[model samples]
Target: MTPPANAPTFLAQHGWEGAEIQPLAGDASFRRYFRVLSEGRRAVLMDAPPPHEDPRPFVAVAEWLAQAGLSAPRILARDLERGLLLLDDLGDSRLRETLDIAPEREIELYEIAVDLLVHLHRQPPMSGLRPHGLDQWLDEVSLFPDWYCPAVGLDVDGAGFRDAWTAVLRPVANDGRAPVTVLRDFHAENIMLVDGRAGVEHFGLLDFQDAVAGHAAYDLASVLEDARRDVTPSVERAMLKRYKEAAGEGERFEAAYWALAAQRNTRILGVFTRLWKRDNKPHYTNFQPRMWGLLERNLAHPALGPVRDWFDRHLSAEHRAAAWAQAA
Candidate 1:
């Protein structure tokens, strides 16, 4: 494969002249990653181009996670002006891949992830982060009408959708409880299970530049209600119980969990659809049915009354089935 245009110059400038660079798997963003080998030393390079992506947030969040004693990749060298970062190579054993090979280890891996979240929530909020509040939630869900709905040949009242969601989320947003550091994309794909590290340090975090001050339950929902894979009901129940006991937030936490799960699932439906329709990455549509199942399960909770009612009235089961079929 041809090397990136800037890789040679960037590596040379960093004293990694003639290093071997191999492409690593990329996610749903414009950023690309490469594994660099120089003098038997391995590190990862992130290429985030300007006018499309920025690396500042990733750098800042990495520092914060390290200060909090977590396992974020260590930055070795960076050129933010050109959006290149040389980072510690955290290995290739993603938790999802490990679970795929050893299905029985699902419970163990998920437990470790939950424990990490419990530790994170226990820490005081990180300063200078934006809140993932009502507006952000609505902005995400609006994609349903703007992109997903159209892709499926259905018309939705976008304004009405926002108004209804506002009513559903206002109580939680105005509860006066301070927000926690929410790693917005905490899931199997972004979490690595490193060898030889004890406890939470064994879990390597990724794609957390989108971190924000949000309800603790939001990340909990992201993990248990994962869009990429099936999480058994038994595992979900156990993890929730463990988190409740560890965090000591009780019923309020439970309520918020379901609410955020509902919101996250709703937004994901739109996001996956947008990925297929706008980004030309059609594979995301394969997860729509799983996402829809998770959304329905979360909407079952009484705390999601308004949002559930809106779905029932506007997007019926028949419509959902038709939309899924069309998108798939």
Candidate 2:
């Protein structure tokens, strides 16, 4: 697509000039980005809908990250009203695309990612970036009945799962809490490898607009418990072990890790459902097994026994159908 005549005008007003433009490969979300290759300067241009994908959160998070000295993409220009963002080019070096590299190299690069997560998690709280908190979590978890119920086509049940979720969270929410920035999507796909070597310190981070003050283990789960790609158990274990050594497990680390993981995984399930029923894209339904894995993992946690019991009864049909339907 040719750059709009007004597009150059917008860039020129912002002190960017004379650039050759090409579209950068996009991700699963509604946002799209392009590479603006200029004279000895390259930038990424992001296009997002105002209602669905605002750049305000992304802008705030990027500024905070820059101040903290992280290797994230810097914002070059933005049209907040239009939700268009111009960013530094981090290159086409996603960890997901290059994962076939040797295991040793993979582990090395992952360690660097862990280090970055540690840095963000260690930062002090800033307003407007915290988790949607208990209220949002409650609402989010409640959606299970709305979507998972229909998908499974199961006999009706009361709000038993919600009661269990609250009962389990009451003590943890009261007793232990640590706050820090959490990049909700910190998987390999968003990371840019600088050095060809795996596990090196040189890398650029991207897609951190959703950063929020959250539990310390949230981003770690984002990396280790990745959705789009797989992280071998051995590697995930190593990454967690490294995080534990570096940060010293915060209060109820494992509990929080699994809790936030459940939250994240549920949010993804709803998103996938919306993608199919509302957005007309059904490929996301292919992630049925992975979504079930997340649900089961949360269930297996001892504290989540009540939640697990409900899922065991309700999710069985959905699980079986999801598997067999996709296979067919």
Highest TM-score among the candidates is held by which one?
1
Q: On residues 239-308, what C-alpha lDDT tens digit does candidate 2 reach at each position?
A: 8888888988743777767777776676677666666666766777777667767666666778677667
Off by over 4 Å in 1: none
> Which regions of candidate 2 deviate over 4 angstroms?
1-6, 14-18, 27-29, 155-158, 195-201, 317-328
Task: Please count the clashing residue pairs in each candidate, in the order shown.
Answer: 0, 3
**Candidate 1 accuracy as lDDT:** 0.86
TM-scores, all models, native as reference: 0.96, 0.87
Local error of candidate 1 at residue 320 (angstroms):
1.6
Which residue pairs does candidate 1 place in steric collision? none
Q: How far is candidate 2 from the true structure (C-alpha RMSD, Å)?
A: 3.0
